[model samples]
Target: MKKSIKNLFYFCLPLLIIYVGLEIFLHSLDYEPKTKNEYLEKNKNNLEILILGASQTERAINPEFLDFNSINLAASSQGIYPNFCLFKYFAPKLPKLKIVVLGMPFNAPNTPKEYTSPIVNHLNLAFYNVNTFGRATMPQDYLLFHSNQDYFSSRIQNYFRDGNYSNLNKFGYDTTRFYGAYQAANYNIGKINKSEIHIENEHNSKAIHNNARYLKKIIRSCKERNIKVVLYSSPTHFLYNEMRDTNLVYERDSLVKNLMEEYENLYFFNDEDNSGFEADLFYNANHLNPIGAKKASSNLKTFISKIIDNPKSF
Candidate 1:
């Protein structure tokens, strides 16, 4: 029996060593969270603006286009709860932070935790030591390779195959362009998954309310510091926009409006309906490509300036 146990341990030792080596190798590479982590660690005190939300705002705003010292902490599949948690953790570190721009995607107010992938949570823990999972995190939570084997495998494979480290730019923006069919029939076909359906079900009352509470918490946090809060919705393809449920979207807009009326430092920039981004500008039906991001970033810059320049004019 002892010999059998010893043989099993010996056989698994090499596999364990290989896994540890891969984890170290993955950590050494640059990624969105890794890049953002390093930058904030070095320059958080000088930061004047911080952008948080999911992919929509992540792809829309480019810190390079802004005049202020800014950082984009947004990532794809980032939930409102995680956004609130991140802001709560970093707000004190940013002495010069004057504005917080939150991208209000259709699902922002009711984004489910299930919608937030294990990889998103893993990256948050691995890079920032943040527990976006809303519980006491374990050691494995901070592991890039152990958190999600599929994600780690793909990342490692892609890294070796193409010598690529990340899909994000220096400011954590995804610059990948949309190259697939963009018609109404093909709009976000594969991207629309269980999360989308779960959010639209209208039966998730608890999650919806919790999301609102977290959002208000973020707004209040900024207001207490005399920092401005901008809850903006970037442009979505008209076809994708047209498919949204009127009631759900209106509820989200109403919540934002009410919050604006309730808070002195809150502002809402309604580009979701007004900004018409052409097909060439979209990386997907819901996200903008590099060129579109540049244009959007410029417009956002102007918006921020106008509001800050004359607070009452907005």
Candidate 2:
């Protein structure tokens, strides 16, 4: 029994040492947390509109177009979960907040279950504390060495390889034209030979329910503070629409319609159905080029003006 105990100690000693070493390294690096502290410090008081969602919303929304101060908290490949986490973090800080525009993409339902990367969670924890980490919609794997190690390694490699993480906010964003409009050209209606929306129908229904829940949370939070919440569907190429037309897209639209009916404060603007534009305006099936973005922005401005002018009509 003494020999067995001795053997166990020997086996566990290296792992314990390694774990301590890693924890010290992670705390020292100060890379995972990114500029969350700076973000909080800068925008705590000045921010008026908060945009949240995946890359599309990040790339699409030009805060300069609006009259109020806005910040794009959108991250690549993220969805409702991160958005919720961010809202919970910033909502208290932004007491003067007027609007929260949430971008709902058709593909949001297809997001994986383990969507929250460890690095992101770690950063969130460091900036927002353990409560925020616990509030993450994903399961906690904070103690998993493999998970944390992988996250740390990837973040370090990315920092050295990219040379600078600040590039993410360089121009910040431009209102002159949509930044990624060219990506939309891949889905021109005239060029399309095949038309089939590939997204799963059942999953789409689930996504819509998830979206409704997400919207409800945002709406409730905003209502408590007298902030307006608007749900806007950004424009996608006709081909992308063809893709979304699959089972999931239909269910998502139906769900949005249901939500619109149920909530007086929730508004849905269907840019996809808006007429008066040619197919060439699209950069691809999922985005609008510069021209399309301008037109879309104009349409949005008009819609917003009307809404602001007469909130009761909406």
Candidate 3:
């Protein structure tokens, strides 16, 4: 029995080492979808503007719509943590960075603590230990022992099946749908019943507190580096506005207003005041369609221009 156990352990040790080494190698490489390095390589020193947030910002700002070179580093379901990581990575690279537009969603404040990307953590670790061969061992352990092997196998199988992993550019910007603005519009905000508004508000408030802390840190860091930070909320459909009215208008507005007052460099663009825009402009209650994104971008450009022209007025 002792000899059998020893043989089994010896057999598995080689497989364990190989798995860990592969995971570490993949982690060290700049391979994560929509990561900062990927964007930096494409945009480089030409990036005049940086847009950060979740999917809302991803879909809202199209670099083709503007004269300046812009890149959206937003990811789906990403909260302040990844945004902070992105800022830390890109801020130093962008010497000519003129503007940073942050899409401050209502849900940003409510992101759960465990919402970080496991993939991102691996990337960070690998990057941090780039010179050493053993740096990737940790991620390898995670892949071998902690992560779901079946899910990982499925991912690998699908990657080859769909040919997605073979094409790195597929994970890059999407020009057809304007980098996911069309998809954001498809997010259904009307599903929330009137009764659920209050519950969502209460939950969202807790998120807001978490959001506020991270936002404050981001703002402070930007200010220290002389980088301008614009805090803007994208236009939500009428139903979303109604939901906000039902539960979060006063609290949210007050929180934003206080931040604006505290930071002389911060600006807020609230779209709820305009009620005359066509409903077709919106894809849903929480996000704008392609046309709406264009309009919003135009308005933001004009707003930023005005701020540049008259710094004190902003």
Candidate 4:
């Protein structure tokens, strides 16, 4: 009996140690909380526009050009769940906020198998600490919280390599340094292939419906507060537009149009248009480089001004 008890203890010890270590490491990389807290401290009740979404918003929108005080709270691959969580956390604190711009792209995957939901983190839970995720309960909240497998590993490496938390700028935008031009293959200096960038049959109704639930929740929340919601698809390379338009695969585009029809306060921008951007402005098929971002921001400023002036015009 004594020997069996000792054997069981020995077997469980290493796993216990690893589990504890992982928990500690994840908490250490809670850089989002720190970045958010700092932004709140500086701009609490001062933000007029709050940008939320994945990486596109982080790289594309510069709050400096906007007519009102603004902050970008977007992160790379952060997705709609995080967007909802972050908005829930900051919306109440922002007394002057008039608009919430969500960077929901055309190709945002919606299938359950595509990615896990309740992608909440310990830091986010500690701050936002909500019991529910839109219409669903987030079971992962009580289980274990890591941003994602890849992000978790990257954060661990970054922690050991001098604690690099440079992703968030003072304005709450990710101003990661990039240089040189985007490399394109089999295209002229000014032309890009549409087939390479178009995402057809990549999403089904289930996936779109799942994401749309949270989007509707956000819209309702904003509506209750009398704030407008702008759902914008950031610029993709011209190839996406040319290919999708020519091939006539409008699954993603159709879903967005339907959503626009459903909600009066929810607006869509540049959903099917890429004429506003040149191929050289993109870093890859989906994201824009700095020059492209500047042009997008300027156009957005004009659109926002018009929206602010004529609420029912769209």
Candidate number with greatest lDDT:
1
Candidate 4 backbone collisions, by pair: 110-207, 111-207, 194-239
The ten-residue window of minimal lDDT in model 4 covers 111-120
Order candidates by TM-score, high to low. Answer: 1, 4, 3, 2
Task: Give the per-residue lDDT digits (tens) of candidate 3, residues 190-284.
Answer: 44344432213445556677778877887887777666787766666566566653335666667778988888777777654457544556654
- Which portions of model 3 show Cα errors greater than 4 Å? 9-36, 115-158, 165-171, 176-200, 204-210, 272-284, 288-295
TM-score of 1: 0.89
Q: Report the candidate with higher lDDT, 1 versus 3.
A: 1
Candidate lDDT values, in order: 0.79, 0.60, 0.60, 0.66
| Model 3: how far residue 136 lies from native, Å | 15
Candidate topping TM-score: 1
lDDT comparing candidate 2 with the true structure: 0.60
| TM-score on alpha carbons, each prediction | 0.89, 0.67, 0.69, 0.72
- Model 1 error, position 152 (Å): 2.2
**Candidate 3, number of clashes:** 5
lDDT of 3: 0.60
C-alpha positional error of residue 193 in candidate 1 after TM-score superposition, expressed in Å:
16
RMSD after Cα superposition, model 4: 4.6
Per-residue accuracy of model 2 over 197-240 as CA lDDT, tens digit each:
23322363454466567667888878778777776767765545
Error of 1 at 203 (Å): 5.7
Which tens-of-lDDT digit does each residue in 1-314 have in candidate 4? 99999999999999889977886657555454456566766887788888887766767786766667887766665667677778887898899988999986655534232242334443446444543334444544543334466766766787788675566556645455344234544224345444355354354567667777778888989988889898877777655544443322355557667777887787877633667676567666667766677778887888888889997888
